[model samples]
Target chain A: MFGKGRFVGIISSIIAVVVAILVGMVFALISGGNIIDTFKAIYMGSFGTQMGLASTINNAVPLIFTGLAVALPFRAGLFNIGGAGQMYMGAIGAVLIGLYVNLPSVIEIPLAVALGALFGMMWGILPGYLKAKFGVHEVINTIMMNYISIYFVRYLVSNGPLNGVMGTARTVVIHKSAFFPILWNYPIKPVSISIVVAVILCAFYYWLLESTKIGFEIKAVGYNPKAAEYSGISVNKNIITAMALGGIAAGLAGACFTLGEMHFVSNDFPVEMAFTGIAVSLLGRNNPYGVIPAAFLFAALQASNLQLQLFAHVPKDVVNIIQGVVIMFVALDRLITYLLTRRKGGAKGIGNT
Target chain B: MEILNTTLLNQTIVAATPLILASLGGLYSERTGVVNIGLEGMMLAGAFFAVWGDYITGSPWVGVLFAVGIGMGLGLIHAVLTVTFKSDHIISGTAINIFSLGLTGYLLLVLFHTHGSTREPVTQLPYINFTALERIPVVGKFINEVFFNHTPIAYIALGLVILTWFLIYKTPLGLHMRAVGEYPEAADNMGINVNRIKYFGVIMSGALAGMAGAQLSIGVLTQFVQGMSSGRGFIALAAMIFGKWKPFGAMWASLLFGFGTALASNLQGTNVAIPNQFFLMVPFILTMVVLAGIVGKSIPPAADGKPYEKENK
Candidate 1:
């Protein structure tokens, strides 16, 4: 089923998976759990039934947004570390529009999503502008912005217009009209409108990269900025546009969480979700196509962690250890290159993806 | 007014010492063209190791040594991953942070059986008496209380700044270090070992930053807790940038930020209308503004995060 090119990618991916499993096993043993039972627990938790499948999809939905958010700027050769900040802003925008507005779902939902996207775009564009205009490394600036967004959101929840009457650091529940209703008979099933929306966005993202002139420019700029500039592609403009678009995608992820799941903005919207997205994008080699599978893999691990804890007595951070191992193995591309060199005639690049 | 002058000034220098040490650590790596975002993790490792060493050995000086050794080890890991293996700097740094959290958290569970570990008051870093230095009244009080009364580590940090200033400007190795950051290709062409210098510089940063962490857990708090470094590493990064990659400039910036922290801490008891959280936000906000100002003009080395390959086009 797999040729040499496909074989290499598959074999490498399999190796990554095996290494990850082993890392998980080591942690499970240390935490006083039998390896086989832990493995079974994780399997059951992730894919035991229809409900498990649905939960996996639910987890993958937000990851898709965050993955695309990171992968877009990465394709343009910029690292968007501020996706966490953008996601928070997106949540804020979605919550405001979802709650305060009294339009029909047909109008209200799209408006809320758009507002979230716009909020994300604005957040990303500031650093993009600074990077293009002033030549600041986006990494440092984006990190600072993450704290700003976190604290700013904290300020809004506590003291600004969104503060609850009880004085706790959270906003009022969003209106039911704005909520993304369940799309399946089973309450735990994986059929939210968010998944449908995510699939549509994924199709759009693939099209944006494969079929568009702007996409070509972004790839060109990423490959070599000087060459792109020489070719009159406006390298700086493309960098800015790609980052802004990337930020919008992250924001949309936040909107999905707000509209689909929680239906409210709280201070405890998992900080690690954004970081997990980083892991997903990296594990997927920052490919938009790869994110779907990568996200599912992580979502499965997360879902399974619940059962693993109950049956195997493994700590939930076992998932983090697995993630760490996967990243470490994937990062050893030099080793992968050496391994593949003998198989090929030295003509094929081993780890370009 | 007199009380205000002494207390505020004293707190500023006291707070500034650790920041200055950490920022100096940042300067060493950054000057050699490595973006060391793992500093926070390294500082945490140092903090934990220091306390662990202190508890075992019953000597804070030994704890300081333990921190330096551990910091160097962590720095070596970063060096191998980013410098030798060509991993992404940010990803490697993120892994370090996550691993530190897990490792420290796990250690806490196993070793201490408490989430937070505290030492008996006996093994604390003994504060110094500066009677000879304190003879000059108001100014003397500020200097003695703020600068002199700190543990041995504070004086070491001040001496390090002067030594670093001399090393960077007055030595051949220093010239090579700057060359490696500014133009690695040029340095490579001139037969300088860029990789070795970068490794030395980064490990040096880790050792110094480890001392900063040691100062925090042993000298001030007398305890080790999870997430103890907080955002000090990032703040030190800000100091490095705000200081325009100069040692003295970083020192001054760290001192200023330290003063801001001291003032904010002092105002908590006062009946002020502003929330204490807003005051907490002051140092970070100032860093943003200062960073933006220096964004274009402050030149990072040409090959800052790009991994060095000896034989590439």
Candidate 2:
């Protein structure tokens, strides 16, 4: 679902996505790529076959989780750039249990996931606390936390106490007890029940943000802090809550990647995926409903990396540019609002966050 | 021991040169009320283009010029988005960063026909060595090694610090820039062109940042490396804050962080008990600590990051 919204809002969002894709295509054309072949390759790579569709879902599963992580804070008008660190913490938490704990499948599975979220929540809460208490900006703080967490993980997997075999740069294989149940037994990477988890979380996200009072307070705080304070909302409290909740979502993303897909933790996890969540959130207009399709599109485009390179001779990095373009288009929210609103009250700075 | 300190100090200034340049660039944009987190991206694009330009032209000067132009281009985009489209400053900066990352990586493949890095090293900027002074005793040797022996950009960085201080504090234009940042309405009432000044500040930042990136590729490394800027731009941001947004303050802060980086690099592979990762994290951790400590007490420009919208009567 694209969310129930004003017609202009829906049109603008769609136009943004289209314009971004077209921009990517233009780049491809300029780089001597055959547009017809590139299009065919992209189509066939992500959606052409049963395996392709399954792969898209499998890949989109983690993104859906991370998309929620970014979009939730974005709703509260905070940019949680620390998703990479939060995800790393989550994966580490899940892996530590998956290797060290010996328990029944059901109990250990949920326990690992919960602890993963808890770890991520802790990591996220620190910056949120600092921003709320002090005037400390979260973007730089979160970025610092990401480097620290990434390096911390590097230490754990490479030479620290949690390192598996010598020079392997990975933790030991996670126990079967923590494995996500297979929904489809694909040969390369199985489609897990985590897809179901991802969907349910998206649904829950929609309900939490759209229908709940907590979400109302967060939005109010985001819309105007001083005004929100007058309306009996504690800005500090909402800031912490939003970041903590976003942490939980990002943590789940890591759990899905680790336990459901990789089945073991490694030092070289794709932290760029966390950055992609920003693109996904912006493209989704920071809505849970829109995030599903937005995540699917990004996952599909990413899956085309191989085919595009093989047939069209286009580097898959074009996808990254495409995502960046989407963000650029989305960043024109004020201009779009200005045009749509018939120039009422001109654009304001809104807020720094 | 004196020799060792001299070596460390030399390394510190060399290492800090890029940060010094980038933070000064940030000083300009911020002084005009635009928050530029995209310094990282602008620097990155500059680094890629620097190598590309030199590889094509057989001259590092051309590469430095290309970097300046590209950096300014990106800065222009930032200005357009924040000033013209009235987009949120941070979001636009984030977009610039991502866009620059992909563009650089992609262009690296297309132009260089190489992945990740270039095989051909470009000509490096000449190091200003006082070879004759090396003949003298300790004081001459110290003077030669400590202050004089560096790439030209390092000297330029130092020069710019003094220049920026004079420009920002002494010049009428600098007062106008600060006025625009502090209160656009007042500046506009005084007949200052707020948007034009902001564009100039932001574009100037891009040029300086781009030059900083060139320093990384051509001045320091002599070859372009993927992700070479590697958070230096953000480190510069931290320096800007730590320096209280003053040019001299930021230069000192940059040197402090650069010293930490030099120590980390120097300590690598040593028998020191600390993990290399922890050593690598010192500057970042320090940045966070600095932000947490300084933010409440240290104030930014009142209207910094707020897009100036002309009042419609």
Which tens-of-lDDT digit does each residue in B224-287 have in candidate 1?
A: 8777987787788888888888899899999989988888777766778876666677776777
lDDT, model 1, position A226: 84
Considering the two chains of model 2, state its CAPRI-style docking category. medium
Q: Which parts of model 1 have CA positions greater than 4 angstroms off? A: A1-14, A49-54, A165-167, A185-191, A342-353, B1-5, B56-59, B113-124, B129-135, B183-191, B263-272
Please give each candidate's TM-score.
Answer: 0.89, 0.97
Tens-digit lDDT track of model 1 for A93-196: 99999778989988998999999999988888988887787776676677777777887888788776787656688888888889887887556453668888
Flag clash pairs in model 2.
none
| Backbone clash count for every predicted candidate, in the order shown | 0, 0
**Model 1 clashing residue pairs (backbone):** none
- Cα lDDT tens digits for candidate 2, B175-284: 99999999999999999999999999999999999999999999988888888998899889889988988999999999999888887777775778888988888888
Highest DockQ among the candidates is held by which one? 2
All candidates: interface RMSD:
3.6, 1.7
lDDT (Cα, 0-100) at B298 in candidate 2 = 76
Candidate 2 overall lDDT versus native: 0.87
